[model samples]
Target chain A: MNGPYVAVIGAGQATAEQERVAERVGELLAEAGAVLVSGGRGGVMLASCRGAHRRGGLTLGLLPGPDRAEGNPFLTVTVPTGMGELRNGLVARTADGVIAVGGGWGTLSEIGFAMRLGRPLIAVGSWTVEGPAREPSYPTADTAEAAVSWVLRQLG
Target chain B: MNGPYVAVIGAGQATAEQERVAERVGELLAEAGAVLVSGGRGGVMLASCRGAHRRGGLTLGLLPGPDRAEGNPFLTVTVPTGMGELRNGLVARTADGVIAVGGGWGTLSEIGFAMRLGRPLIAVGSWTVEGPAREPSYPTADTAEAAVSWVLRQLG
Candidate 1:
């Protein structure tokens, strides 16, 4: 059986805490037998791919730039989109669900696309998007374990 | 000399006023000898393509789904990305500049990508993004002519 394709979206320049969280999330996802998809660059993305790589999980990185070398070493498969920040949409689209760690404008863009496409999303120490009613649009998790659990459950 | 590649980003289902503005924007861009690009589905996208098509301007549509038939009839060329909403990043990446007519979440995602990529961007009665200092991030034009003029000027 094919594993679920889950994308981990976050900032390339992430905080130490965010990196730790993302790595744990990646490890958990990989252990669950999920195919990991990411933007395929550093910091949060790198950390997540590293975790998954060490666990012998399949990792796919959709690079924003055209050069494959820009992708992190941990990725098992890399596609250099050369589409710049636009590749974020592909990361969101290619995934069955999404887990966001620390994020910035680029990460926000992915979150927006994921929600717009009606994909299941979970955030761990990430940006919060409020709906018209000023309510949080998606569920949030306190830890990486919670996030992975929630996203996997939602996928199921 | 080749004309500039400007993307018209907006909602697939837009307000009538937005559609009118988008059509005029497309007409003005065509008159200026600029190539038009859009998501190429309906509402603002269709109106812009229609205006540009009538003026004999080249229009390219980057479709979200895999089917080319889903694109509007007015598009001169169409690429079905099968990337879903992720194709919004391609639309933003492929253009030299972007003009957003009133938008929804999907349009907002494109705007986010454009700004993140540092692509010259102008909003026409579209979403407003503020920087950390609470200042407007990009220029906004009141009219289609003004939008085309400002984006073209920014490009030059």
Candidate 2:
């Protein structure tokens, strides 16, 4: 994580499995000394940020609103987008690679952005993508550790 | 178009059918006195801008890069975002309604943003969007005329 930037794109209101995955991913990213970026909301975002902050990792949140106060408290930097869900593209652009946990429209959008930008992406669990291309567009992992490892390998 | 603003979100490089749809949507928006907005690159964006410009309608392009020169010549005003594809959210936020003429990662992101913001969206082609609450999220149309009409009707 020291030389690379990896973003964790996941559900804002995560499921139990997604929450666990995001937290572990955050902790791993922090341990690797990589900076973490997210949408700065609840659910997976909150969990990831909390994990990263606990591990003493730097975290940045791209908030949809105009106020930094709207960001999750775990974030070290708050980028006020005032662009709502559109900020997902920024998350993709900012990351050298990305780890997607669970699935949702927002996460899907981030995945699409990452693919379009030619950034590496690792998907955890089902993509929840409708009518996705049959062949895997990116790497898929079953656990947060595997996802983070794949992203790091891609970065390396 | 004079009274309202409509954004046409689609692929940067589109197929023949999509080009026709975008052009007609732009022309129809102009004829209905609604301003045309787009990402302002090529393919659908170019066709729509060309259509609106030919009809003496105002056209605005929200470009992702820093250079206004990268925008299509058809645009009346080229807004240089320097935010890469992140500018798609601005395209969605600026419009009163949006017409999605084709499918791509960029276009899908716009659709998600529009839906989250509760803005009216008319999908002119298949988007492969998942988990969109089947009822009252957005309308789907097969033709440019129908799409523009639906947006205008909603605006009215």
Candidate 3:
């Protein structure tokens, strides 16, 4: 059985932190016995996969197009949603919780979708602050260890 | 006047790379005198905004919820789309070209939306790989420079 599933959304076009963050997130998800989900690319998503794989956690990459291989190597389950960017909402909505790292337009869309769908999100590490009526904004942690710890508290 | 209006979509969470990559991309856009569009939170979008602002570029953040102030500090223009996650497609389609950085579900959705809408996307870093004619795949890139360069070539 899956422990907990979390969806991570961010920029694929990034090079430095994007990739590093994804890898760290992936590792955290694995260690936490959680499944990591991403758009299935490089940078943040790939980094997430690397983290998950290193810890032997399950990783899922939802592809925007027909090809499944477009996902990162760490993905254990790859869902090819031939939907296109329209699927961004679906992906965000499908997750139990979400985390927004540094983002672009794509990441913002997911944040919007998650909020609209009323899912719990942990905006950590200099991300956005939560507004009123939603869950209280958790502490912003710089390292993945701190971020994952916050996620566990929220899940609990 | 704007050179070419483009939208960047990806995760909002942060890692070490977020600031640098966002700044670099913003610099490039500013050099071209283009308007930078994003989800308007933190991480890459904020970095992008900071970069654009430094060079006196027009930065726009398409916010999801009601308050535009919830956007990044660097945004010169903030469009509060009460549309929520569904509006992600609008952001994707709104741009002439879409760029992907390190991202998750929301980014994938944008890519999916773009693909379905037949829009152009240039993926960089490891976030994901986008091709107009095929299904979406996530390919990894080690650096932001490589990802951005690949995107430029793909756009050409």
Which candidate tops TM-score?
2
Local accuracy of candidate 1 as per-residue lDDT tens digits, B78-124: 99999778788888888999998987778878877887778899888
- lDDT for residue A17 in candidate 1, whole number 0-100: 91
Pick the winner on DockQ between candidates 1 and 3: 1
- lDDT digits (tens) for residues B90-121 of candidate 3: 67777766666665555555665665465566
What overall lDDT goes with each candidate model?
0.86, 0.82, 0.67
B102-147 per-residue lDDT for model 2 (tens digits): 7576776777667656678888774655442223446789899899
Q: Candidates' TM-scores?
A: 0.79, 0.86, 0.50
Task: Name the top DockQ candidate.
Answer: 2
Order candidates by lDDT, high to low: 1, 2, 3
Candidate 2 backbone collisions, by pair: B1-B33, B1-B34, B2-B33
TM-score of chain A of each: 0.96, 0.92, 0.85
Score candidate 1 by TM-score against the native: 0.79
lDDT of 3 at A118: 64
- Expressed as tens digits, the lDDT of each residue in A56-136 for candidate 3 is 988878888888878878789998888766567767766777876665555655665675566666654323422212334
- Residue pairs clashing in model 1 are A12-A43, A66-A82
